[model samples]
Target: MLARVVEANERWERLAAQLREENAALRAENEWLRERDVRREAELERVSAELAVLQRLVFGRSSERVRPSSPAGEDDDGQDDQSGQGDGPGRRQPQKASPRGPGGRAGRRDYSHLPRVEVIWDFAGGGYCCPECSSPFEAFDDHAFEQVDWRVTVRVVVHRRRRYRRRCACAGPRTVTAPGPPKAVGKGRFSNGFIAMLLVERYVAGRSQNSLIAGLARQGAQISSSTLAGTCAAAGALLAPLEEAIVARNRDSWHLHADETSWHVFTPDDGDGPARWWLWVFIGADTTCFVMDPTRAGAVLARHAGIDTTTGQLRPAEDGGPRRLVISSDFYTVYASAGRKTDGLTNLYCWAHIRRYFVRAGDANPTQLAYWTRDWLDRIKALYAAHDELTDAWNASVAPAPGRAAVEAAARLDDAYTAWDTALEAIEVARQAQMKSPGLQQPAKKALATLDREWDGLAAHRDYPMISLDNNASERALRRPVVTRKNAYGSRTDAAARLAATIWTVTATAEQAGLNVLTYLTAYLDACGRNDGKPLTGPDLQRFLPWNASAADLHTWAQPPETG
Candidate 1:
């Protein structure tokens, strides 16, 4: 009986061991399944977020504005109401409307600068007499009122050059004829003024070539598309020197805003399809330049901004000093790559771009993450407000050159800087705390990651007060070209693409200098015509640069050209 009992115990022990091994294997399998389920859930969330973003982009508004929610115990006006008392019983207080002057309408504009024409009225019989009484009336002070009128006409100008005959015929031709008027194109039909109008209409006004042709036809001028294209080409060739000068000035600026957009080029196929091109803009305080390139790589930035490709550092200035350039741009890797390679170049990433990430996250899943997105957006808004304060203080400090006022202004500026630093610190603390929270969702987490990655660049503006908080200036400079691209579907050839860039550079730079674009183009083309239908060089070209132009020239360009 003892042997049997020991055998039974051994059998039971073996059975228990088998059961333990099976349970361990089952646990491992179950854990793997659970992990797979978690991964699937995360993937689903990401896909949903992406779909939401795509939908918003396709159907939602383009504006990135987000209205902040009111805090507890505060009203919409941002006033505290801790008592929880109502304005009245069962009746809300009415909001006051904004005041508008003179029957809520804008005042009449002054047209004193326009030319005036008089029209006198008389009786039917050419006598100042009343019809009913048939009696003559003495003329009194005339009553008058003004009415603006517009008329567009097309006419041919006939240059009447006089011819004279030499009686002595002394070592010269027997007859001499006066020189004809200058022509923008050699033996071309159009005048310099006509070419200027065509340029402004197509480039400045963003009108297509076909539209220009039709408009001119309506004005009694029959012109073909080829003719207009040739005119633009001729004008572009003449203005190439000026464009180069502008580019040189743009590269010399210490601070600049850079941006780029895609452009389609229908180049001839060389065993390959059409090539994709890019349009780049670099805007300074008083200059704007556009460049067309076949590639959208760092080389374009390097070439235009004078950076050494190998070292990624700016070349030495003309005075042999280190060249320092601060570029404001989006968080493109090329800019960051260049920034990483050198100390002389600094990249200021746009805060507006960082804010856009959170904006998109909030829009993607408004029902679940609206509050979270708004909190982050509010933090960014606080940064902007603080920056505005810093800007105002800095401007005030610089306005008064050297005086007691400047001393006081400098103190205020220092205070503003301190406040700005405090604000930045608060944001950093909040970002860190939120990153550690367990309830964070995938969208918000991704947004935070971007913010963290670009934090140093976003905050770099504090070191240089002259730089702006965003790259809106460069973006604004690109609007005109974008519109033209949409209308014309980009240039047809490489040469045409380059010509577009040159003309756009001149027009945009001229506009930045507060010059009338039409007037500026007309004046420049006339100078080109006088230069024997060739591009201006040396001092002549420098005189045409908007920044180098004299005050008298600027005043003249500001006025509207007379129409006969």
Candidate 2:
């Protein structure tokens, strides 16, 4: 409490000093007669507008969520994916302040541990007396209310490891005592729990290093910000094997969702290159891997997915066998190039992204758009509806074991695919008829060009129903890191950026596999400590991998998700 108060006072003093300087400058501005009042006002307005834009760029909401004129159906059970949020305590706290109203407000809480504090209200002489009559009065009944008694307390724990020698033991009277607990950072005073908490608070909770320093100082730790940063970097380096495991696991998957977001780092891949770093997210069915690079080039995707960008070739999986891979991504040029460069690779473009362009086009030129945009939306909707029906049929018909019904479901899917083709053909015919003259406005025309460009990739999913219609899975995986990026304004150096990629890979992959990040980190760090900071490999490491991990092992190391 004292630390917070002092810090707040210091900030106020600094602001006051700034304001004082500004006031002095204003007082000395009598030379303003040099400019016309109207022009000066106009200049002030322009500066104010620019400042507002800057403020928005720096501090506005970071959600780039596209809400079309007609809302798209949810890809999940209507549950929006949150960066660090989960079902209970020890979960990731939401990075942003909750907006107003019922959705923002949480349900009734059960923080039952009320600290006892009392304030007694009584009349003169500590008695219930009538003040005007100066006479004692009997209290009829007691009224009570409850309120939170919140305060801050800070302390440091001193771990005292006692050493003792066996005084009369036959085993040479060797010195022995209980082992001291492991630390995430070697030779660090902080415990593993403290380090884990700091990590969660920083990355998952989206708190900056300076914010962490202030918070610890409030707890009387008085630690420097550099110490926390160094600890985090050390922890990332220590648990790098787990990150590699995630990437290796991704390599083994047949289908993956790939996406990337802008990041900033001082010493990027090329020192002379712009710090326009890209954070790539490749999420397999069971694993999520985050990698940072200096370019948005297809080469990063190629390198990580174990493919040769020059030729459409995949190197082999861990089993030394080539994979028949399918990649789903947004309409980025790099994704297309990467897909084309790989053999037997099916590229599925996001349908939602396709729809978003048309939606924007319709918004820009609503009158002309009504001629064919509505037709396009209807056809798209019909296609999705058929897909949903087929998906349901497949789930209902396909049995646990190979059977006649499984064959029947495959036939039914094939029939649905044919039917979808027929529907698309009808739309194409209508489009060809209108292509002669008086076609679409520039907005709609541009949108049609995109559809034409991506049709092959968008329809590639017809051969594979297992792929999603959208690249939402990968986008959702990047949300937490994106929020942290917004908060920290990105990393300071290449090493830090690389460290973040490694750490976030393990954490996000564990989250995808429904594993508790804290427990996973602790176990991983303990393993590294036991191995003298060596990376895990072979059978010893395979068991720790999420895909190979046993149910009991996951439960022991991290909480398994609740199932219906």
Candidate 3:
């Protein structure tokens, strides 16, 4: 009996020991899991915060949507693409003639410069007249006014015609051809104007197809997404050649600004992955041209600026060809050796680039380097301001204006140039001192050294009127595609990317030149279609541009608008 009692006690002790060991193992596992959960939570929170910041930068807050704000012109020098002539940003279009004026003429200029169309509502022979006076009210401000607001509307129309046919007296077949103007987008429900509107919205205004369809419907054009997309595709096909010709012409200029930005295509990665493409842009000296190549390599640059085969070099010559170019680009190193053996070719380095190095260095160490860099920029700013004021005066004079009074203006410009030279000399001395300063760290010192080395190329503007203070031209040309990358993601196929590059080249160039892009593009395409296999040239393009006679006189060359 004693032995049995002891055995029970031993069994209980063993069971207790097993329970303790299992409990301890569970506790350790729980602790490890708790720590792993904490780490995962922290990682998730960090990623979430970063994503939110990026979203805010790209798309703005949920409560408020962000629209792209146009970039401002960097400088007011006459070299800016904003030379009061281009059709797009910073440039002004010629004011169209108004239909009303003092003289009872048909084409009178409206004296009303502002938008307010004033009218005075006058009550006549009514018992309830003005409260202040029982007498009938007279016209207020010598006019009668009634206000109503209206919005633009677009609609589709369909036309059907029945042909008249007769049997010939000899029992032969006879038919009568009925015709009006050739259709632009054949058998399509939308008007030519509406299709043009769609393109302008997509390309110029930078709206997506969903946004565009919604906006057009709100404006009274009920277009399906598929319809709009199809219209866009057709327009792209029709306008492709004209776009190519415009790029070709621009590639033939004496000087050009070149740059590239990113783009994406749909289904780039077999409908799952993303692919990248580059939108390359080149603008001519007259600020009247543009070209887009899909490649960012030196080969693309070489192709545009003609090459000398034997020397394996690019030379700028009046070869009555496009080779005489002075390219303005960033310090990409790709453009570094372009002017090595090219005659009539010069590489003008960008001051903005040199200034940027100092700007960044100053950000890291403000007290010593930043202040000096800022001071230098302030002087540069002053020089630009003076140059702008002089240029504005010159523009107002319409320089060498067709009269004896123009002599004084010409002389004044020469005097202003002389003063500009003196200011430049002082700038050179300041730049030299910054390079010689030993207080800067390695990065700042390196930046200063580069400035000193490239001083001649950076300050080439002083010697040549055609040279510019910044590479803003190329930078500006690249802005659109960069904006596009965030929304569209990027390009899918190389063909789509090439198409985009071509389109940008033509549109931006047309805008830079103050030519109505749609007007020029449409007319230019029509001419190309009619010319058969003939290649488009600059002179041919001049005939169809917005500034040309054909825009207004479309009657002789173009069929008149259909009369009901």
Candidate 4:
């Protein structure tokens, strides 16, 4: 009986050990499954966020304004409009003012700048006879009306250069013919004015070469697309020096707005197949410059901004003095990298871009994160409002080497600065607090990370009051090129791309100066023609720059061209 008892106890011990081992294995498996589930959930959230962004891009409104929902029982009218007027019950809504000022009907357009053509109608008998009485009616006064006329005619100009024969038989040729009118191209059929028109229509107006060719054909001028393209190329080359001058002037500015867009160049493969080029714009106070580069790297920035990549320093100015510049741009790494490398180079990030991040985040999960996104957008909007107030105060202040008005304006500016500072601090504090929150979502966290990373740049605008909160200037400058790219699909070759950059620089800079694009281009191309179809340089080029241009020249260019 004792031996049987020992054997049973041993079997029981073995069964207990097996149960313990099985329990340990099950726990290990469960832990691994939990970890894998966590990873998959994270991946799913990320993908869902990406999908939401893509959907918003495709179907959402382009404006970034975020309208928050009203609280519990409030109606839509509970919120005041931009003018602080509400349409709530018992409140009289203000009527919209007439756009025509004091009258319901819109005023007629003034065509005084256009040339007038007089056409008189008279009786065939030179006098009108009254039907009731057999008497001739004599007119003492005439009733008149004005009608604007438009006519576009393309005609061949035959330059009949007179020839003089040497009657005395001097030691020269028998006949001496006057030089033919300066041609924009060597032996090309198109005149300088024609080339200028083509450029204005194609580049400034964003018309495609094919469309221009067809238009010319309709006007009884049969010109091939290639020929038109060649004419544009020649004009671009002639204007290349002016483009360089504009670039130099742009780089010389203390504050600048910079932006770039993708451009396709088909030929002269840049090692990579079907090379993707870039068209960059840097707009100064008075000048806008465009540069075509194969790469969108820091080197391009360095080259254009006069930064020496090797030393990470700005090249000396013409007077051999240190140069300083503040660039307003999006949060592109290249701008930041360039800023870091060069001394005295500051990068002021775009608030609009930072707002876009939070905007996207809010869009990803609107129901859950809408309030959070609204808070951030409101904070950014406050910054803009504060800046505007500051600008208004400064503008209203009188000058004359700083007087009492300036002192008063400075005080007002201080108050405005306080508001701006409060708004900025609110953002920073919220960013910090929410970044540490345990319940934060991935989208919000990502937006916070961008804000945190770009905090220094976004706040850099405080030091430079002249700079804008957004890089909208550069973005606006790029729109013309983008439109042209859409129409013409970019240049065909590397040289063509460079030429495009040159022409775009000229046209865009001229428009910014409020100069008539056609008249300005015509004058420049005519000057080029007189220079033997070569580009103007040195002092001559300076005269064409918008800021340095002569008043007479500017006045002439500003006026509307007369029609024949």
Candidate 5:
């Protein structure tokens, strides 16, 4: 009995110790779960914030501007809302629509320049003699109102070049014939006007190939897609030399804008892997060039900027002076990398991009977002407004000595820069304070970090007045390509990609030169035809280049003279 009691007590004690160990383990696991739950909740909040920003990107206001007004609860222009406004935060006053001004009488549009063809209408006097009054009615004061109309004309024009045989009696049967006029394409059934219409319809108007063919079919042309594509591809060959000249103008320009977008191209002929290309555009004072590359690497930009791609260094001109360029672009690393590798290039950032980041950050934060956005927006307005004032002041103020005018301008610019720096200092103080606050959101923090990282680029324009503070020019220039991309999906085959770039180069540069796109293309094609399909030589090429062409040429090309 004693042995049994002792064994039973030992078993009971062992069981008690095991139960305590199990309880401790369970408590540890419960504590771990509590910690994980807290971390996961924090992560979920961050994700939710990001989702809100993305949603705003899809559906929010398109413009990044906030239109600076007075601070919340304060009246605009130093006026009280209620004549006794409260000190605490309050709602913004609703905007009122301005009254419309009296509209003047509408005037008729003049189209007298168009040729007129009058058709005479005659009636039989004998039929009118006996109907009602037994008196002949005479046509008096024929009514006429011009109606403008256009028609789809399908007519075959025959060119009969006169041939001459030897008139001498001793002639051995020799013949001479006058040559026919140049065609846009070699021996094609299409006229210069017809081919030009295709270029304008597809590229300038952003019409897809399928829609273009259907429209032409309705107009009685009934062109096949393969034919159109092949013609466009052929034109690319002729345009290659011209495109190189435009590219040269782009690189040589002191101030330029650079941008890039995705361009798709199928590679069935090349046996390439897939069809994704990058269409890079560079716009200058008198040139716009587009290039299609399979990669968006810094090397692609280096070549255009005259930077050494292999060593990532500047390739100075023979005179040992680097090219002077102030290039504006977004925060893409490639732009920055290219600018850094080249000594001549000074890359600047667009204020619009900076505003975009702040806008997105502000959208993601619901509470206190309005106050923050309004504050930053007001600062941005001040920045631009100050720059404008500086520009006006420089233009209006002249130094006593004409030789010292540039020096005086620089002095005024420096003063303005100093004043702007003061404003930025205040903004920085506010930013640093907000960053330290517990309520600051992640997006806002990220935006602040970006501004800090790109501060040098953002401040570039203040130092150099020639450089524009906004990349709006480049963005506007990019609109055409983006529209075509959306409509056509992208180019097909390597040839098509090259063709698209070539045509856009001509179209865009011609627009800059103020030449009508259709007329210019027709003239250029004619010039190519005259060159016997060979690449245009020095003077031959100069005649077609927008920069070199005379203003009279542009005006004539803008609208060809018509005779009745």
Candidate 6:
């Protein structure tokens, strides 16, 4: 009896220890769940903030913002409320009611009012043409006819240049080339028209390449993927010099926008890895330029901003230097201290970015953070409108300088600065309140504080007119790669990625300049092949753009004007 009791006590003690261990694990899991919930809530808030800013920027109103449940409906501008039915494959606008007839009823127009066409019937063939003449009658020729309309798809011929070669009687063979072919695409596989069509289908038309090819095939043009790629690649190589020239111009420009995004590239590993890609866009009130480089570091900025790495700052040209650059970018530490010579780089922050944090966290703490963010966004909206109005007034009246504009842009800038100060104060107070509140968790507090700390960058544009009020240009440029990422999944090799970047650089630049991408690309390729002549330059290439000139003009511009 004593031995059994001792055994029973040992078993009971072991059971008790196992139960304690299980309870401890359950408690740890519960804590982890709470932490995860906090983090998720914070992420949701950030996304909300971003959407609100995007809403205002794209739609020009904050109150009209709607959450997109599916990615299918959202457009490039983030407007998804546009219905696809009537605008797409559904009921069309009702046509106006037909005019009443003579008796107050609808009737066709009188043929008597129109001139009569001549009709001839020859009684030369056996068929009865003219009953008056019983002899054999020929086919009836009718000049009088009814107009008919129908839709038919046909393969339109873009000119194909034939190279003529002649063998001299005594000497060697001579070849006459009719200024080669258009530069936009390669000669052997694709036509200039097709390449232009491709760009239109992909970018402006927003259709996938597969869809484009299938659509073309239905229209009787069977183009393979390899052929399309080759044509694009060749044209891209040709247009490379133009991009360089644009970059050269940026060296003398007063403002530039810089941004980067993740680009996935396939490797010989288990899964795809992340590759950082940089996109830099510069606009000088007139022209726009875009570049896609692989590097993410400040070195990419150094290359485009003309920074001398040794001195760790920007280097002006030999003659003189640009006065200032109103740079708009995310608060990356690298650019904050990017060594600018003499006058420090004028750093204008994006208010759109600053307002996003609070909007994103609204659901978690809707009362203070959300309300405060909305108020700050309103002030930023006023600032944006003021600048736009100033620009429009200057444009309308042809003002010589920013200070002399119809809107007094400089004064507006000062006003904007004051607004930023007020918004900043409000944001800080809300942030502190969130941090102190027990109900508000770390994620919501941290995200708000981040925007609060970056106030200088968030409100940078108010200092100068030359600086943009936001990083919209850079973000707009990033959208191209993002779309490409979804379609191609990613690139296969480093070279492939480089090739894509090269193509994207010129293609995006062409779009920005309102050039017909196909025409420019084809002409560029033709010019590239004629390397024996003067190498094509950017300004020269600009004249051949499709938007600026007709296809014939581009063709003529691709070659020297016969050197007469």
**Candidate with the larger lDDT of 4 and 5:** 4
lDDT of each: 0.75, 0.66, 0.54, 0.74, 0.68, 0.52
Q: Report the C-alpha lDDT of model 2 over 1-564, residue by residue, as the tens digit.
A: 999999999999999999999998886684465456767875774565456334433443322243333333221112243444222212232232223434333422222222344433333344333334434444443333322211233223333333333333243324433333444455655545556666777887777666666665454445555657887888877677777778877877888899999987744556743377899999888888888888788788778777865565987666877678888999998878767767767789998788766655655544445446666777777777766765665565646347876777777767776777776676567556655555445566667778878888987866666566788898888888888876666777888888888878878877777788877766766666566655666776777788888899788767632221
User: Model 6 over residues 233-268: C-alpha lDDT tens digits?
Assistant: 565566566666555665666677766776655551
Q: Between which residue pairs do clashes occur in model 4?
A: none
Show model 4 residue runs off by greater than 4 Å: 1-28, 64-182, 217-221, 269-272, 395-403
Candidate scoring better on TM-score of 2 and 4:
4
Could you give candidate 5's per-residue lDDT for residues 1-564 as a string of tens digits? 999999999999999999999999999999999999999987886787788667655545454433422334332222121222211112222322223335522322233333444533333322123233344333233333332222244323344444444433442334444445565466455555556667777888877777766665454443456667777766767778888889887887777789998887755355663467899888898998888888888877878877776777666765887657778999999988777766667888988888877766666664556577677767877777777766655564544346677677667767876777776677677767877788676777887888878878887776665456788887887788777776676776777777888888888998888778877877877788777755677988998888788888878887842322
What's the ranking of the predictions by lDDT, best on top? 1, 4, 5, 2, 3, 6
Model 1's TM-score against the true structure: 0.77
lDDT of 1: 0.75
Q: What does each candidate score in C-alpha RMSD? A: 16.2, 24.8, 19.4, 15.2, 15.8, 16.1
Query: Where in model 2 is the C-alpha error above 4 Å?
Result: 1-155, 158-171, 267-274, 309-312, 316-322, 370-372, 395-415, 437-439, 530-540, 560-564
Worst 10-residue lDDT window, candidate 4: 81-90
Candidate 1 vs candidate 6: the TM-score winner is: 1
Candidate 4 TM-score to native: 0.77
Candidate 4 residue-wise lDDT, 1-564, digit = tens = 999999999999999999999989999999999999999999999999999778656655443443533223221212222222212212222322323324233433233333444544455545454444434443444444432222365654444443444444235444444444555565466666677777777877777666665665565444455556777777777887888788878888888889999988766556543468999999888999898998899888888888887898999988998889899999899999988888889999999888888877876667778788778888988989887876666566535236676777778878877887888888889989999999988999999999999999999887766567898889878887777777767766788788878888888889888888878877776777777878888777888998998899999888666554
For model 2, which pairs clash? 312-341, 312-342, 312-343
Report the C-alpha displacement of residue 87, candidate 5, in angstroms: 60
Q: Is candidate 3 or candidate 6 better by TM-score?
A: 3
Tens digit of per-residue lDDT, candidate 3, span 207-281: 555566566545544445556666666666666656655655666676777676655554453554344445666
User: How many clashes show up in model 2?
Assistant: 3
What's the lDDT of the predicted structure labeled candidate 4? Answer: 0.74
Runs in model 6 lying further than 4 Å from the true structure: 1-187, 199-213, 267-290, 320-323, 339-343, 367-444, 518-539, 542-564
Off by over 4 Å in 1: 1-37, 64-155, 162-180, 268-272, 399-403
- Candidate 5, TM-score vs. the true structure? 0.76
